[model samples]
Target: MFVTNVERREERKGPPAGGRALDLLGKMERNEREYDETIAYALALASAWSYADPQALHDVMNSLGFENRCYAVTLSNDAVSARTSASLLQHVDGSAAILCFRGTEPASTGARLADTGVEPARLHAWKAVQGGVHSGREPMARYIACRLKRAMNGQSIVDEKGELVSVDAPACSDATGEPLEHRLKALYITGHGLGGALAALAAAMIFEDKEHEGIRDVVRGVYTYGQPRIGNEIFARRCQDTYGRLLFRHIHANDLVPMFPPPSIGTFEQFGHELRSSAAGWVFSEQPARRADTAPFGSTVDVLAWVKQRLPLVRRLQRPFSSDEHAPHRYVSVSQRSLRLRRSELGLSLGRLRG
Candidate 1:
């Protein structure tokens, strides 16, 4: 059946009415049994890119229909340092470019760093995007964000065999002589574990429309697996307002990494679509409907009332912090199943899907 305009609006937002949760589950296919394979390939590619080996990461990018692969590396280890590795790839079709962050690596100190950075619910001002800051949101894991920021600024690219790479080329300029924010039609960011948290924060930054730089109007989606909370309440709401269902958290049974920096310990929260694997198959859960006016906020007047409303949610999101369920391949397996549907049939525009 054709979805009416009002229905689509209601699906993305919510019924023009009251909501109890964060209004995540908008309009989803109720009886749909199949998933989109193309999305699976893209996600699989992202999972592979998380590895540190350049040659291996390069090979994975090629398999996923991407070219002009670039790798992001971070060297700082202090509160102001960036430690994780990320990569960039322009889709072979030239429809989109992707920023993929590698999740927590074995014996990596960054994997255990306590969340420290915090800021308001905004991106680094276009004019003040210095000091390696991406979003104003806190608990952003400063080290990780710093690394990614440096990688982006460097704009380094890797060759086919991952042999030739450089940061020597100057930045690109548009035909009109304006600086391009990024060259691809759209930007899609993804990661697992710590990378997932960084990816989420990065997604929030990419969609912000401030000033000066290439226009990244096409932020395709921020897809994450076993991702932990990345920001405070206000930041979460900002992401929800900006991306709606385009933000995805793919959870497998009992994955523990998603439970980090427990919501009870801080203002952290998840923002976007939530899909989980089940005994039968995989299932997607939109946040329960919520209204900004009614939802509990940090500024709420009654502390008792706010805790009463939020405690349950925090407990529900926490899982034991140990499990093989946190792996990336497991995420790809389930996401491929639940994300099935062609763009035309999904009622989404080709621009968002391809770009």
Candidate 2:
């Protein structure tokens, strides 16, 4: 029932008081050209805002009807990231900016920008990726934890040491007195599957806490990879019922994390309704899973090489004949009563396939 083919259902609903917003979003999704145009407009606005005078930028945003204080905050964060990557926010207003930079040497570019009078109100700097202290709050850490737990459980995990244990445990402090150990948390589990499950569990715990207080709308974002767990669905539905805003789950198609084998109810489809309504939902961006040569065993080598090395024996597994050749045997194996029940329940025409 969860995987029903119907495009619309009464049980599925949008945020209260946001009917117009939902309509606009739905229209955008239905028209790919319009959707892309909107994105281009947003990007252009961002680009123009970056070069406009601070006051002019403010006026432009205000004229566009984006008056929410939170919108400004989100925009500021986006601006900061943009500036770091492509100078897209270089000339934007810096009076209210909170700049957080991650890289080795803290990138002299930021310092030069400050020297040039592009003073950010707040700045926090750290080494990029695996260079600095490991924070358990990050998705990569959660992934490592999941794999470690699976390995400890006697599952065949590949590149366990390379992926999970490659980083040295924190041993020193920066110029600031913050201890590296305090910055990183040890992972409690292992594997992308379990990592996704752990993220759902974390979200569920937060939802439950908010529920106990009779408070909703306390959460703003929930980012996770791969398929959804049963607990995730329960929590997500509850969040929607109580607060109306749904969680955002990101899944790269080629990663195979979001779509595991066997058709079943998944978090991706469950949240698809919400994504269809969100302002910037369901962005099918490129994820470096296969491109980066990442594998189930957590190796960074070429995907084919890693697979061949780790699962060489699987190459000998028998291959199935074409679906057309196998169809008759598959149908003959089904019980008459079961077929009748399926036909009655789903209105399917198996005879069409036979024909």
Candidate 3:
């Protein structure tokens, strides 16, 4: 069934209408018996994409809710296929699987993060620490909980009773008095834009803490996509000083979200480390759509221009950081076949079986 322009207009009225549609969509998607039905419904909704209201799109997403909706399918013969719901499309598949949601809003992004039990306050603190402050002694856990509770007020993501209806975090580990590895992995720290900086801070804390030696090496690589605001130079430097190398930062050329420059106080080069920047190709105009198999490395001129337009301070900051010159490495363009091969090497399959 085709969604008419009138239906699209009706959906755009307010959150309530959007919520209703989304709830219906999510319910359908979650039922395995109704997978085809839901897919049909989603396709119908997607058709309305041309004239649909952005708010309505968000509401529909809220309705679907988050459920490990996407996965890397492993076949009986050990072949892997990357499968995602109709709504979302794959962006980049390589050493890490990077997927983006289509037509998402700040509210939905926040809800997604909250659902993972990562509240705004914790993120703020994470951002603060990533800017080079030590938050170990701070009452971070309590503060985060309190701030999050306050933020949930008057929001649809929460119920009338002020209880969250969608988000749930895994229980913190009792044995180690820390968050579980899988829990941390599941936490979409990068959803709300500041996730990269927060993750950087979290990584710094782990490296600095002598007691966390068990997981020190585990925090080595940081993969961030569409990280809106730039992180603090001091924080990046702290990571470099401790880890002896800066984290790998990947960006999609068209992703305007992460292109925004860091504040003057937290310039990218201030941390005295070299950022290994790589560029990938994005499929859609907006973020979180299906990506191509191979990503191209931005040319030197292109990369410099990107920094100047998006991160002006980086150009100035790059000079001093060159003092501790590491051997320059050539940027490798990623190919689709390479990505598939890489996944195979990791004991996963990346192709779908034809019916």
Best by lDDT: 1
Each model's TM-score? 0.58, 0.24, 0.32
Candidate 3 minimal-lDDT segment of 10 residues = 323-332
Model 1 residue 44 distance off true place after TM-score fit, in angstroms: 3.6
Candidate 2 residues lying further than 4 Å off, grouped into runs, are 1-193, 210-218, 232-236, 243-246, 260-269, 272-355
| Clashes found in each candidate (C-alpha, N, C closer than 3 A) | 14, 9, 9
- The most accurate candidate by TM-score is 1
Better of 1 and 2 by lDDT: 1
Off by over 4 Å in 3: 1-192, 228-231, 244-246, 261-338, 341-355
The digit string of per-residue lDDT tens for model 2 on 1-355 reads: 1112111231254221122222222222233222232222222232223232334433433333322111111111233322211110111111111111111111132221121121112101211111011121232333323322322233312222212111122321212211111211111110122223333433443344433232122222333333222223343455445432333333322333332211221221233211110123234332312211112222221234335435878645332211111111111112112223433444346555566
| CA displacement after TM-score superposition, residue 27 of candidate 1 (Å) | 21
Q: What lDDT would each prediction earn against the true structure?
A: 0.47, 0.25, 0.28
Instruction: For candidate 1, give the lDDT.
Output: 0.47
